[model samples]
Target: MNAKQIIVTKNSEEKEFYSEDKLRASLRSCGATNNQIDVIISQINAHIYNGITTNDIYKKAFSILKKFDRTFASRYSLKRALFELGPTGYPFERLISALLKEKGFKTKVGVVLQGHCVTHEVDVLAEKDGIAYAIECKFHSDSRATSNVKVPLYINSRFLDVQKHWNGNSNNGTHLKQGWLVTNTRFTKDAVDYGKCIGLTLLSWDYPKGNGIKTNIDSYGLYPVTALTTLTKKEKQQLITRDVILLKELYYNIQVLQNLNISANRIRQTKNEMGKLLHYDTFTNGTR
Candidate 1:
């Protein structure tokens, strides 16, 4: 029987009997169909590890998948494995947040909300100096190196929306100041360029020595820390304050000029009336 079918039927004791089935079983557990497993088995010269533990079974499946096409090794596949691990939930958010904390940054997990059409709670909301930032986590499949698209653009749009909603102004001060797209895979050159042009920060993550997410700043194709500061919430607020003050001063100057112009026109009208009164008196008396 295939691993998926077996998984539904067998208990712990029964599962032990199938442990030594090797390639066929491991491939099935990794979501490969019988036909797919047949092709992979045909290519193998030999198989090692006569006795496989539960953990070894997972490793073996991942190892076999590395030999397959990359399209099958997407973020979708990694999430499926996380689901199969059990019901309590994979610590995907906590895993990334801990790494950020180690870097002397505070991280809040699952705070930002998207929309009803799309359900996404951001992995981390990092903050420093009263400014918040976003980090989206993607756990890549063991078989493939990391890669992605769309996240950068989505972040830009959502950021603007969040700013408009919470700040009571067009400026996005209450939301994340800057955006960080975090993933287990490395980013492509075009993605990095797009991020640089529009002020998005990309954080590439790797498995740490002990396990869980760790920062790879050197490998990460992020904009420099200097470039990202302007995108922060605090900086945006400062710019808003300066603009407000300048506008207020301009309005006050305009009001002063308007009042002065009105007073001068009134004085000219009063003088014209006085001249008309003097000319009427002389004409009525028949004097030069």
Candidate 2:
């Protein structure tokens, strides 16, 4: 099969060719070693077929990755796994809250606060070291969709209102308050421009390039519970609905899987996978 044959993407768009360089880059981005990356690329090249979907290619590569390193496979599957958190994004919000907590910030999900003029339910509120942040987490199931300018415009307005009322409240210990717009997808160029011009912190999948959401997730090893390949969709959904959002959380509380009626063998598999996924040394070199 020719690599230059058309391939379908997740969004159903057609690309004329598949580039080995691009695949290698993606593998490297997910912390695959040079030797492992080369092996994966060679395998992918050997299996290339006309009309192959990118999704299929990803699955093929992931299966190969799992054989070599389950941890790297989990990291590589982060984006797709994130999409599994949704239909409602409640799980994503919880995951974001957990990630912030890992960073030494006190976090709250689905917090409803009264602004100067109206009530706003912030997706995630993070407070640390006398600074409080009202974060709006926008999750997208579609890979092609972007968090656009209007979202920040609306969020900034709400944040302004909240800041006005909460400015002098000493009880909250908020010496400084800011608004952050976080998304699971990329940000539009206009959105980035607006955020930069107005000081709204926009953390999208790849908007800030080197220091985006994927970068943060990789840097802190904050893999979501959805990233566990051993767990079934129903099992993952049960965990997420019960607020078991982080892989680290599952690692420490292995009994939670028992509560969900997962089998002893599956529970053990989950633990081993989490061990690899959250191992600090595995992610140390990948941080930006």
Candidate 3:
């Protein structure tokens, strides 16, 4: 039976036929090799059926991928990793600030600035090359939801208010250059169009093709501590509560896991996985 004909339910509650090409692209996005992709597809093809969910398929794939290697499974779990950043926006906002800091921007998270009309609490304020940005983060725990036109429409208005105030204030010789709406999820066509028309920058997981949140995070190897498949969800949250967000953060403080009462052997395994995930060790295609 052709898997393409098998109907599948997506996280968004949308139903569509399963497409092999989409699966291949997703695997590739995480640096899956051709042979590895072929193996995964072959295994997946065996169990697919009408009304099977994309999430279930993903869980199965992740389970198999982890047995091959934790790092590969971690990368394959990137989207879910972003979701793990929050039931709140603060961690997500801090993440964006960190990514901007990587790109040479001076950033502050949860900033309060005066708008022309009123005071606004910006999710993040970033400045680089004498250009400032009033950034608003739309962090969604729901992977299926996309930010719509209303989101950008509102962001543009907020930007204008802040832009007007910044231009008048001289901003220590820096002018507000852009307003950025960053989200972990995707944006709707109308949202993109409005952002483009008004000159607001709309950034999401896959926007702008080569440069996006996903691309930047992958390029920088800034996977969150939550991405460690070795850690349970509760353990990950424990790390988050202590302000340990990224894998790099955990790498430096491997001893912190002991505070959570994690086993010494499990901690060693996590440390080894972190080395591979952060590229501290050489990257390869097969199981370690």
Candidate 4:
């Protein structure tokens, strides 16, 4: 059965909902392994109940995955569920926009680029210090590094895409400068290099621990992936503390954007500098 046809929906609260059984059937038909199915089911059971709609089911599922759990939560599966949950991509868009705004960057959503009259949905269009940045939030599993080549490629191509928007009839160019790839998983070497070659920056986190502790480090604080690795009892507790601090900081930053008034040109400049800072090489790695 195709993925679409597999899901059975009912209208509830004036919205469509999908049954757990239907979700499982669709995942299975999509070639999900038994283990993946179990992990998904466990997430469902954790929050499953009567009156749960399809969107509710996925929201719960992705929530369970926000932490980087080594067992059961496949990043690939979580990513699939996320995109599948929204045709225009809601939670994902809001999450990215919220993250950027916290950094004091001004933002715009769903920018329209001319040519083919194609409307490309951007998660967050950020501006700071006379520069603009396009942030694409890709929440995919590690497996998608191979299964979904387009994820990285799209990140690589965003520069040209954005440039076209600037150069298009509108001439909104101003300080339009760079792009960012924000993902829950690490990028492949090629993807990283590609970003560097074209001056885009890729930011990803190590898997979080079962308790939802992020590990890797970046401007965003503890990488969400680190939240879920094996650690001594004390270490685990420490990890949670770190995640809390990071989250608090994130919240504080986003709050700052609510009152700020900035132009798109400044945001463009900020994004360009961010791209360079993220890609600057370490002497040992022989990259710069």
Top TM-score hit = 3
Query: Candidate 2 at 111: error in angstroms?
Result: 1.7
TM-score of each model, paired residue for residue: 0.38, 0.88, 0.94, 0.40
Cα lDDT tens digits for candidate 3, 1-288: 688899999987899999999988888777678898889989999988899999988988888788777788899998899999889888888888889888899999998888899988899999988889999999999888889999998888888888899899954588898999999999999998888988898889999678888888888877888789999999999999998998888887888999999999999899888888777852342122
Q: What is the lDDT of residue 220 in candidate 3?
A: 81
Name every residue pair that clashes in candidate 3. Answer: none
Tens digit of per-residue lDDT, candidate 1, span 240-274: 33331111122223333233343555434322322
Task: Give the 10-residue window scoring lowest on summed lDDT in candidate 2.
Answer: 279-288
Quality of model 3 by C-alpha lDDT: 0.87
RMSD for all candidates, in order, please: 30.6, 3.8, 3.2, 16.2
lDDT of each: 0.44, 0.82, 0.87, 0.48
State which candidate has the highest lDDT: 3
- Model 3: lowest-lDDT 10 consecutive positions: 279-288
Quote model 1's TM-score. Answer: 0.38
Backbone clash numbers for all candidates listed = 1, 0, 0, 35
Candidate ranking under TM-score, highest first, comes to 3, 2, 4, 1
Cα deviation at 74, candidate 1, in Å, is 24
- 139-206: candidate 4 lDDT, tens digit per residue: 54322342134566765465566566565535564566787777654566677666667777666544
